[model samples]
Target: MLSKEELLQYSRHIILPEIDIEGQEAIKDSHVLIIGLGGLGSPAALYLVAAGVGELTVVDDDLVESSNLQRQIIHRIETIGSPKTESAKASLESLSPTIKVNLLTQKASPEVLNKLDSERFTLVLDCTDNFTSRFLINEWSVSNQIPLVSATAVAFSAQLAVFNQKLQHACYQCLYSNMNLPEGNCADQGILSPVVGTMGTLQATEALKIILGLNKADTSFLLTYDSLDTAFQRFNIMKDPSCSVCS
Candidate 1:
């Protein structure tokens, strides 16, 4: 049951016909693990907290640098020296004290992956920029039977997908069978601020849908967007029977 404060805070969601009180309650009871606190993770974390996800675990080892201020809205100039996880935790707590925030001050590693208790999280959000971390997350999600919402953005382009072994949806590896990392990093490629924000927000939306069971109709679809042309595209993704990670 939500407290009077929660009910008041989430009145907008409760009033929505698509997401009634029950959906809002599911969001309030969901636990999300967000990997990375950079471009894509920033907006996703903010929206997830604002949408009343009960628990959030933010994993990032980097500290706030002056260069990241333009795209990482969660970190301010004053927080330049502070840890990214600390800044995100403060932001989320300030936005909604009712929500619980966990800060993992280290980069997520295969060792760290081993330490994760799969049962604790309802879903994992892969906001990491690199392919190594992305692949690791995909493999971990498949092995643990956890659902993962992955998003990536660079140079006005973005992609979003949901992978769940339990649901038998297409895993991330199914989309890219081979590991070929993006050539330039966001730091080098120069990402448009709104591009990352849009992708991250969409990722949060997908995560919420997964938690609320609204994704039952369509489980394996890839959504891509190009901010330059304002074009959005969706493609049906199939699970690779020979996938090394999930198969």
Candidate 2:
């Protein structure tokens, strides 16, 4: 049950017919894990916390740098040189004191990821940039039967996808069976600031929908955005018959 303060705090959300009191309550009962505190993870973390997710675990071993302020909105000029996880925890908790923000100030190593499996997280956001991190996170999500919201941004383009093993959808690997595409490293390839933000906010939107048991896709679908045209495209992702992760 929500306290009077909470009910008042989330009055805006409760007013939405799609997300009424029960949906707000479900949001309070859902726990989410977000990997990376970069451009994509920043907005996702901020919104999820502000929306009152039951618990949020953030993983990032990087430190806040001046370069990050261009896109990673969760960190501040004062937080420069501090661990990203610490910076994120401080910012998120300040947004919603009732929500617990767990910090993993270490790398997203297999051991660390495995320990999280016991938590039975309701969903995961893969905001990491590289295919290696995405592949690893996808494998973990598939094995744990947890849905994953993955996003990537390079230059002015971004892609968003959700993979839910419980729904038997195609895993992330099915989208990119090879690492031949342009990598998502913003340092290597320049990016427009809002490009990543658009996808990150979408990731948070899809996650909340899943938590509220609304419009959860039964099959995998990928959403792509082009800032130049201000266009959004959706494509189906079929599960590869030989997919090693979610075959």
- By summed lDDT, the worst window of 10 consecutive residues in model 1 runs over 178-187
Best by lDDT: 2
lDDT of each: 0.88, 0.89
lDDT of 2 by residue, 111-207 (tens): 9898875455999999998887888999999988898899999998999998877788899988888547664479988899999989999999999
For residue 8, give model 1's deviation from the true position in Å: 1.1
Q: Estimate each model's TM-score.
A: 0.96, 0.96
**How many pairs of residues in model 1 come into backbone collision?**
0
Candidate 1 lDDT, 1-247, residue by residue in tens: 7888888889999998878888888898899999999988999999999999999988999999999988998888988999999988888888988789888899899999889888889989999988889989998988888899999988888888877677877899889886455577687888999898998889998898888877774557788999989999988888788988777
Q: What TM-score would you give candidate 1 relative to the actual structure?
A: 0.96
